[model samples]
Target: MGEPKIRRLDGRFDDPEIETAFMRDSWAGIRVQAALTLIGFSLAWIVSTATDLMYMQDSPYFLPTLSARLLAGSVGLLGGAWVLMARPGSDSRDLPLIVYGWILMSTLTAVIVASVFPTAEATPDGVADVLVFTSSWMSLHVLAIGVALAAFPWGIAFMSIAYMITYLILAVVWNEQSEHPMIAQSVVVVACCFFAWLMAITFSMRARRRFYITRLYEQAKIAAEKAQEFSSFLLAATGHDIRQPIYALDLNASMLEELVDAEQWDKVKPLVQRQKLVASNVASMLSSVLELSYLDNAKRPVTPTTCDAGRLLRDSVSGLKDVALSRGMALHCEPCSARIQVDSGVAGHILSNLISNAITHSKGSRLLVGARRAGQFIDLVVADNGAGMGDRDLFLESRSALARINGGQPLRSGMGMEIMFRLAERGDLALRITSRPGHGVMACLRCPRV
Candidate 1:
């Protein structure tokens, strides 16, 4: 078996489910972060403005449009808050575009409005005007792009390109009116724009790297803990379950030895048969354990072919009929005409566990196994008129967590359902359980119909 492929947040995953989940989560966080940062900064700006502590409040360029920028910022803040609940994770693509547009519109309008506003009793220093404009505009550019770094690197890349162009245009406009060292100052501004882009790229990737490593670490820790737990439970479980047949075998062996010593040959054949039954039961138990090991490591390769659904059902129940009858229960299967595409052994094993579980633990006279076609799929169900699981929701929550044997009252490994879960996961089969406490549990395995 190959190693499990790790899911990466920055790149594609081989598994469709993993890829979808990673993208959904990544975008969700990005949208929420972007929205909150915009709203939070707007709130901070309002508080500072009310206290008359704005850094560039006295600057000439900002003095002309401070009220206008504040109004725009407040409006944008309301829009951000509106989107906090209206947008879902799937709508993340449009979120960046909308946010970038809002920032661009507000900042550009403020700059354009301020650039035209004439200063009465004008000072003869043009470079001083450029310096004031640069001071205010550079801060706006930095703040706008700075809030976007939490979004994925892809969105940040697009934003950085657009913002760099916007900054360059602002630099060119201001350069026309500035006197000395204008070229050098423009170059520095562009360099700073580039630096902001590079910083966004660096920090975004770092955040993703941290999240990916953390995901792998958490998954590894959980898997290790579960493995340890299952191991400890299996050791004690095998001892208790295997002891019955082993004790029966010991008794039969002693009986056979006494019969042989007494020359009572008549009873030898019956005793041998009983010994075979006990041995066979032990062999079956061992086989189940081995199969679980294979499934755990995903070592078993599934090769599906066309097979009769009815024959599959019968084959699954055939081995368990004797055991079920011995427990005063009847095993019945309704024939299915639908043909299915599945590994017959795998499907049969899943059905066998479900039916055998019904037989061993359910308080009922009859166990019903059947299959039927439903559009492109066929559902194979095992149901009995017996006491069902106390917590049906928990049974469906996690098979590993519900490690109680046979879906019964005792605290034992829910080994059958756990095995069914592994097989269903490997086969891409849909398994569902429905039960009422006094009604019964219906375990359904849905396979693709051929």
Candidate 2:
């Protein structure tokens, strides 16, 4: 009815499933990146240590440079261990891990630059070389963050700003001895920050889009499978249910032919009636199946009207009276003056289906239809004192009855109950069915009272 809410690529979503999935997927990649970072830092530390010992051991910045590299490598090792050991399914921890790695990487870069820069011999050419070296070193960390850890745009912005602030603070502390100009260093920091932010947004948006496409594809595949199953169930159920009635009709036709040849006029009337009854049953079954199918697939709107509950109950029973009588069952209705607000047609169909099902399957001598008044509602009940169904049978009936229409397992004789259930749902009525072994089955449809 309205525009769907847009999901911002902030690593949090309104839907918990999407949020959990995004975090889980990102964590997988994050773990691999963490391992790679650990290796890279370790290799860098080893190479830098060897270079310092062989060539730059006499330099004033040598100890600080070596110390900074060791610190960075240690941080990388700790981060990698933590990320790898933590469960990827722990969605709440992934963001913290990314932020933690970014902080360590950024702070270490600032420490190394600040400690070594102030002690360097200042020269025009030397300043340019130093800036180039620092920028190149910083860019690696920036790229690692951008490519490895999938972060929210705001998180990237925060890490970038925090790094710049830390660098500026360190630069201010040693401003006098610093060889590089503040503006040049600031420019480099800003550029790296902007790049990281841009990458974060771009990667997040792409991930969300991919997730949506994958989700839709999965849903479509499931629906296709369900449709195929439903088709197979339909064919099997229709064949099994329709065959009995058609066979009865054929047997009646043969008997009628025999009776006519003998000129048995008295039995002819009842035999023809029996044939019509069998044909009627076939038609009813087909109609119920078609209606149930339509109800399952289509959105049918219900228009409620005030109706006399007693009259509605009586009418439903009266229509099915002949069918019940044919099976030697007595159908009775108790009087109730309660008026209910409901979709009368749907309600009537639901009642008739319930009555028919009881008459056909209950194998009982008596069926009762009645209305009872409750506070603000009236319960239209159709109960049968038949051989009764056990708890398992009732459970199966309730489960497979309507679920079968929607591609679930089919019950051989559940169409009538399925029709009743579907109509009750469409009409927004609460239908409850309860049964006990040797105590028969009772169905109650609760409707709003006028």
Candidate 3:
């Protein structure tokens, strides 16, 4: 046969590759968050440096000005650490609390540092210089606002409370003596309050968007699972209904052969033989269809028992000898004499599907089925020398062949494989498939040795 023209289903690729990509993307998001926090801190630091230079020589509040800058920078470092450690197994919930605590501490420290500095005279030229100088201290406030906006919107509520307490203390201590202190304190209070409100709004909008995305993802997942369940039900019903008639036909065909004689067999012998052949083919097709459907649904119950692994393998292969011969393929079973505790029906089903799959896909004359005791388990393998599947195809259908049940659908065409997978899962067996194009395929199913 020419090389099998392999094609994969749309948007369906290897699971491990997709998982790796998801982890990379998640790490990238965390890095972006850390970078944004750093940029906000940098801007605040630059403003503090300019303010410190303006009031350097004669300013009584020079020391306090330096203290505010140090506090803000420290808070920025803490925030960066929080983002860095926000990995899957790490404490994600505690991060927001840590950031909130840092912001609260920075705000209280800034308020104390600002109060220690004496108010300068409101000269025309000095007013502009003082405003520029004070703006550097405002960086701490900006950083606090940014933290509230970026992490969780509700976190601003805690920061706002901390800012209010700090503002009240400064209002009572610094503005009590000056006649115009109320005017100066009011300006600062209004500016901080407005910025906090704005940050709150921004946080709410972002939170809403995140909530919507999460809901949509959950809905999609539930829908996919439901669809899979429905497919399994359809396959089970089809198998049960279709197999009953086929079994009856096989029995009747066998009975008819026994009643006929050789003397008058010339006329009736050919018709009976033809009827039996037709019945057998019909039964084979129906059985395949049912097996495929059952496998696809994979809902069968498993009953594990202790049995001879070698004996089970022999019986399964004996049943497939005629099938292999008819397809011009050889079937051989070599079993290790060991007892295994497993779901016997599931083990049998798995072997059946592997053997049938090998015959269907192979152009080779021989197939091999065997098992060996490995540690506490028996490793069973079915190998075929036929037109083997490519890596991409093997990867796609190895876990669940339900995707290949329809020819037009570019998925496994039978329920038998799905049933086999479900059985393996229930039996706690390790099932693996390996295939190389033009070489052949090998399927391994491992179960605990009794």
Candidate 4:
């Protein structure tokens, strides 16, 4: 039976499900907003016209003539048309047009009301006229402000300041000598202040939501990348560590059978022992890889130990000697005595993988491992006189096995390299690779000497 596959969560913002949800929500919000705008405008128009008609004969409360009403209606309709028909996507430009249109309509309505209305009877008392004008103006301004705030709440403070200045100028500089100018001015001021406060609160909430969304996006991207890295690592580790030993065991078992057939009883015991050893090594390697993966994912605590780096590299080279010899390659370990503080087992694994990789890819029959000291750091280099990689091959990392190892093509090198890199990263070391076509490939692990 095949191993169960692990399914990862799709957290990308551009995922079909997420995109659909966002679009659905945005469209619903827009439709509702449009409907509300239309309703509000209709109500305002009906109320203003009805009130004017109801007090037609009273002082400062006369109905506008049909011609005047038609003119004002035409202007208001044109303004609404411009707002609704202009490019909706261009909010920055469209917002100004919307606001200006509302202001223009309100001003036109005020003018028509003033012209048709009769003069006040005594002391020019026209409180009703003043109230109608102020109320209409404030209502239109508030609508404009609300729309602006909804579109871009961050800019609400600036909009609030502008609205405040306009309101103050109109109430103070252009004050008509109505009986209740003070009351009209006070109402306008209070309405503008309330709207400004609402805008401030809305902007604050929007900023907080935006911050949280941005943080979530960044975290999701990082998690996706980490998951991809882990998946690649697991695939490579399975191919190299798990499969290789099984192959070795099968080869040794076949050899044992041939020895028994030839009546060479002496060789059977050693062959069986070697096969068992290979199986044990495979198990150990698998355990180590699993542990490393677990530690990386869980951010496990690590206890550092001091060990001899030179001895570790030498042992790693020794272990790969038989493998290299089988492929007609010589694995060489240059003399070095540099001692560094690190996990000996992890260091050995890194060196073993690097040397084995060099042997596998070598075309010239030799792989060299060497180390040198430079100030407070030690640089270990693994070089192979292989049909050396080009710049493209040397820099290639995180590619899949099937994509790389097809029909006798060279096995992918990045899995081992990534493991080496992760080890180096955990140990606060630096790993660098340099290669030239037809010359050789070299990898250096530079770690601080302690």
Give the candidates in order of lDDT, highest first.
2, 1, 4, 3
- Candidate 3's displacement at residue 230, Å, is 10
Deviation (Å) of 91 in candidate 1: 3.8
Please write out the lDDT profile of model 1 over residues 76-119, one tens digit for every residue. 68767866877655644567665665666555544444344323
All candidates' lDDT scores? 0.62, 0.65, 0.56, 0.56
| Clash counts for all predictions | 3, 0, 17, 1
Candidate 1 at residue 92, lDDT?
46
Instruction: Return the lDDT, model 2, position 379.
Output: 93
Q: By the lDDT metric, which is better: model 2 or model 3? A: 2
For candidate 2, write residues 195-301 as lDDT tens digits: 78677777776776676677778877986775565556445545645544555566677878999999999999987876676676567667655644443243434
lDDT of 4 at 152: 34
List per-candidate RMSD values in Å.
7.1, 6.9, 11.8, 11.4
Candidate 3 lDDT over 15-45, as tens digits, reads 4443233334344453446435544653465
How much lDDT does candidate 3 score?
0.56
TM-score of each: 0.62, 0.65, 0.52, 0.53
Q: Which runs in model 2 stand beyond 4 Å of their true positions? A: 1-127, 163-189, 217-315, 336-350, 371-380, 390-433, 445-450
Model 2 has an lDDT value of 0.65
lDDT of 3 at 214: 58
TM-score for candidate 4, please give it: 0.53
For model 1, what is the alpha-carbon lDDT of residue 347? Answer: 71
